[model samples]
Target: MFVQFFYMLRERGVPVTPTSFLRLQKALSLGVIGSIDDFYTAARSILVKSERYFDTYDQVFAHYFRGATILEMEDVELTDIAKALLEEWLKHPQEMAEALGLDEEQLSRYTPEELIRYFLDRLKEQKEAHHGGNRWIGTGGTSPVGHSGDHPGGMRVGGTSRNKSAVKVAMERRYRDYSQEGPLTEIQMSEALKRLRRMIPHGPRDVVNVDKTIYETMRNGGEISIVFDRRLSDRLKVILMIDNGGWSMDPYIGIVQTLFNYARSQFKDLKIYYFHNTLYSSIWLDPQRHLRPEAIEEFTRRDPETRLIIVGDAAMAPYELTGANAAIYVGQKESRTSEERLKFLARTFRHAVWLNPQPESSWGYTWTIGAIWKIFPMFELTLDGLEKAVQHLMKRH
Candidate 1:
């Protein structure tokens, strides 16, 4: 069972290494785990190292174990009626409450949380999927679990969120899509990239005045202590690689430039480089930003404290991510693969990140996104995503 489980994880792109698998087996053989939940705890702790793999790990674990169900649901249509009509009820929530048989007196009797509990009581009684029904937990009905129905508030188990009264939402796959998809304004991207430049708490030390600190401390009570009076270094040493061209990348050029400009404003020592899809042998530093005669090994020799940031969509033909002479570089004479170059960068840099302008929801559709995500901790080019990625980097250094 463990062998099949391990294979299933690998097949699902979880990247479970053989060493991790061996560790898990040794742990289980020693009876370190005690229960079903314990196995989950032990397996995940040993098998998964990064939070980026959590979604994939969860999927593979649920599929192989079949112990619990993934509660997230896709948008389902209520019977044959258009979803627009059901959505209209959002405008008339009070009428929906009346239509659902809730009286004003009853609303006064319970808090909103109790009302949700009452609805869940009704939901628990449901046994199967229902559509166009007057009762039971289903769609196109008065049931609270399904959408396009007349209810004050429902769990929104399935179907599109037709009303604002979805007091409970299982999981939102659309939120990420909307965030990374088109319609993202410049202001939002600016705000997101602005969070990347954080004041690090520690850096190269300035002069330490021991005599002054001791005098100051003695001047006060014994309770007072000497202050470090440390100053923050605004020095920013970062390298950026932006994806240059392609039809798929046209929509994101503006956003990428916004991040580029914002990062430039933050770090005076920001080394800017350009690569169309991925990096190969080396990166270029020229007046025209062309990949003009420079070696990646030179940049690799830079102080390890330097942070490297890659801004790209990370979307390409699946084959582009695989092969020795991969990546569309300037000269196209490099001998190493894109993955190898990235591995070298990760080893060389103190903190490396890939800020993808593409939506996270779309990542599962392409194979290379997974490849890149494995190479670097990827975050969307959105404000919240940039914040998360920056926070991770800040904690690391």
Candidate 2:
């Protein structure tokens, strides 16, 4: 059985050396392979570290073991394993939950779901913490390099002595005392206000004079006269529509929280809507309620000054993107064709932007993303992209 596992991994392009096989053999000899669960744990300890091997491990494991031993092990189903594995990925959790056929709230309450979400969130938070979403932070004023210190042909120092010196230097640097100031009671709100302020015009004086004047008046007083500024007439209202699932679960919630904070501080009238899929004929204004026949009509009759920002990965079944029944709740009879929906949505708003998490290079391969791109030409996938989108919106306004 151990030799079979080794051969399986080897065939799957995993570099399972003789030393690793020997280590696994010793572990098995120590009576660690009493049950399938024990065998799996031991095998993982011996073979897996970087999860890049997980897909191969899973494929080989499934191909090799197709009996009750693998299937009926401790009530753990394939979905359970998939959830466990994917919790580490920076992908959409809501989509994963849906694909796994698990209820979102119910899974959220479970230990496994909580563990997965927590891990993924922490990973993203750490990535964001490096430079607050800048992505191009310099390391000790060094230019950004394609490779870290680990690449074989990279400019990193070689040999154990050099590595030890580097580690010593890193350790010697005194860690800053973050304890001086306790964690802000409301970091999200604070960050949101800051981001909104950053989006305001900071260009030539003449270009932004009217905007600055209107903003100043609104800042000092409660409101300003729209008649005073001709440019204000062209400025569009903004409606930010966001997804509430997968990796977006936390970030979207944060965005909403930040928007609310901006609304309170700036006193700007902005509308936000939440949806799982793209809006076709209509969207449910109240997420608590299902989509009604009158929803589209109500949205259409709203002020034409509105601009729309739709934030989601647009990842779903291909049919969901183009078929007659693509709308979330509205039946085929009431559903708008994809093109018509896009046109109506664009016409309703002065400008439209789609903020997607998946990078642009991956767009065309995904049916839903491709469909969204066809509709919203300005779809973007990075923090910088989002910041630029905000700038564009403010400039148009």
Candidate 3:
């Protein structure tokens, strides 16, 4: 099994050397590799020397084991009875306003708080199978609840989403086949990333040498002696989320990784997290995206001073951004939509901006891009865009 695993990694272009393989095997023999997870960590540490190969190593490992698919989709069945009931329930537009003791005119003028309260109140009253009717749990209604419907400020239930209306999207994503196929140079990319730098002064360090300087000045008599002071640099604490693994983003993977590597070198206090298509529940730090699972709230606790930069095209299917459906990886259930997650993140991070790799003209054509732009002032991936994004973050900060 181990020998075949070595051959598989080599075939996958993992640069696995005999020395590295022997080291891994020796570690396993010494009872160091206790579990599957431990074995993976050990093997990768030994065999994979470059960070760029981590994703490929993970894919090869999973392929050999027949494990979870990267962007796997599964079909969830709805019963014929349930489907019929849903269709039957879709007949009337629910009088959602009346259910909460307000009419259409009054509800339209309702304050944000009032609307929330009204929705909550109506939710408490709903008990039976409802459809297009104004008062029941059903479809095609004016009610703030239920889907495939129309209502001002309606809270849509399961169905086609308000793709045009969503204000945000989670920023992290995936990389399908981790191959840096381009001839891009890190030096050039890092130089471009320099546009995003925040050159504020780092906090003061070490005591001043006033006494020594004075003594030296006195000894020199005519001229004042100078003490060389260390220069101050802006110490930035940044949380960077990179969206990867989409067909639309295939051309920009190298661009994204280059930016990532550059950011790591530039921001000493940078914290990186990853996600796919959309952020439903969490973000990850590892290429496998399982070893370091970070909850949504984890981002909120980051220092408010930390500038949160999200890099992605922000182009994806509408369902990935809105509704209750985990459309990409089916059978996964998330209480909040991708839109809600982005809203939370924006509100939580005081300084945040999105850097989009796609051209500005293409943004209007993609529903998801337009949706995200509403919440974040997105900039193009060029130097000017990065400058604009940095300037915005600075101004907001």
Candidate 4:
């Protein structure tokens, strides 16, 4: 019965597998789904593995269960009556509300099912655009449906938010870009980085050691004897170097900085530094690059096990990375070229991953991006990319 629904979910990129569908079938057969809300909750729990895809799931569910052929406010071609009604409603919204007998208290009383039913009824009855009236899919006033309206319940059809009280947004999907495979947020980045944590025993033995307890108990003629061992603590050391130079990097500065600050607070031995375009002799302590620069050798001298995460667009002039022009080292004598510095950093760290803010698809189009990518395992600065990078680093660990 739900074969079409299952296929629709898959077509919409919800990643619904056959096995999970069978499980859902079994669940339905067992009489678990009692209502539309129950079905939504249960189907999502069974089919959707990640919360990021909840928006897509909601869209699919609404399309399948709720009336799908309803025209949004924008899609409705304005008839003469609709145009006249819109003008009249806009001129006197308060008077129109009194005439329509619609208010916030009445709208607030609607349950989700009632709201959906009301929306479908409104769609069936409303054949044109509504501007400021209540009880129709339109803009302004206290409608349970439509955008820029004040409503405590019902679906938002189209247009920008004004009241922020839509039970379900029937507009364009808001979280389309928030899939697990999409771009990175600070929280997602932090969660991906957390997977890199390696816990080892440290400090005092405050907790009971199970293995030791079992061994000692067996040796002591089965007497119950407790053993305490050192608590396991995070031993992961990370050095985050971000590219914060040039106009090309301005867009990525905020998110990258947020991740850096989060990492500094999260990991015990995390060191963060900033660089411009490409790695040179010195890495900066601040974003403005005004403070005294720290030598790159300081990080290079660290233990080889230290993981390095380099966040940059890597979209710079080839000369900036390749050529040792006078600007990079004019009067001062330097032993290493930019390429050599990159190579040295890559080799020094046992596990290093380069996170390019530019999408991976465009990596091949840029020259400098390709050059840097050769030296490190480069991945896009996205949730999927970060997770893959973490997996790569974990494999080495």
Tell me the spans in candidate 2 whose CA falls farther than 4 Å from its real position: 1-170, 173-236, 245-267, 289-294, 328-333, 394-397
Return the clash pairs for model 2, or none.
92-246, 93-246, 94-246, 235-397, 237-305
> Which candidate number maximizes TM-score?
4
Higher-ranked by TM-score: 2 or 4: 4
Steric collisions counted per model: 2, 5, 16, 0
Off by over 4 Å in 4: 1-183, 216-227, 326-335
Provide C-alpha RMSD values for all models, in order: 20.7, 19.8, 20.6, 17.0
Q: Candidate 1: misplaced stretches above 4 Å?
A: 1-230, 286-291, 327-331
Tens-digit lDDT track for model 4 on 1-397?
A: 5898899888877899999999998999999887655676688899999866766776776677664542222222222233345447546646544544667466457553354334433543554344234321111244332121211122323344454322244234554434323224457668887788988999998999899999999999999899998999999988888776554553344456556656867889887777777887778777565576887787766978888899888877787777765234355455567887889888888799999877698789889889998999998877778889998887755
Pairs of residues clashing in candidate 4: none
Model 1 / residue 244 / CA error / Å = 1.1
Model 2 agreement with the true structure over 1-397: per-residue lDDT tens digits: 4688788679767677888778888887888688665565567668866444544554555456542122212323222343346744326657756755676775566564364555544444544444222111111234222222111122222222333332232222211121021111234334422344323333333343567667777877957634232232112356766565333333233333333344434535566665655665555444433443235546678777565777777876666666766654543454556556766777776567787755577677777677677777564534456566666655544
- Let me know the TM-score candidate 1 reaches against the reference structure: 0.47
lDDT of 3 by residue, 179-217 (tens): 332233466556655655556644554445688778888
Against the hidden reference, what TM-scores do the models get?
Answer: 0.47, 0.43, 0.47, 0.61
Assess candidate 2 and give its lDDT: 0.52
Q: What is the lDDT of residue 275 in candidate 3?
A: 67
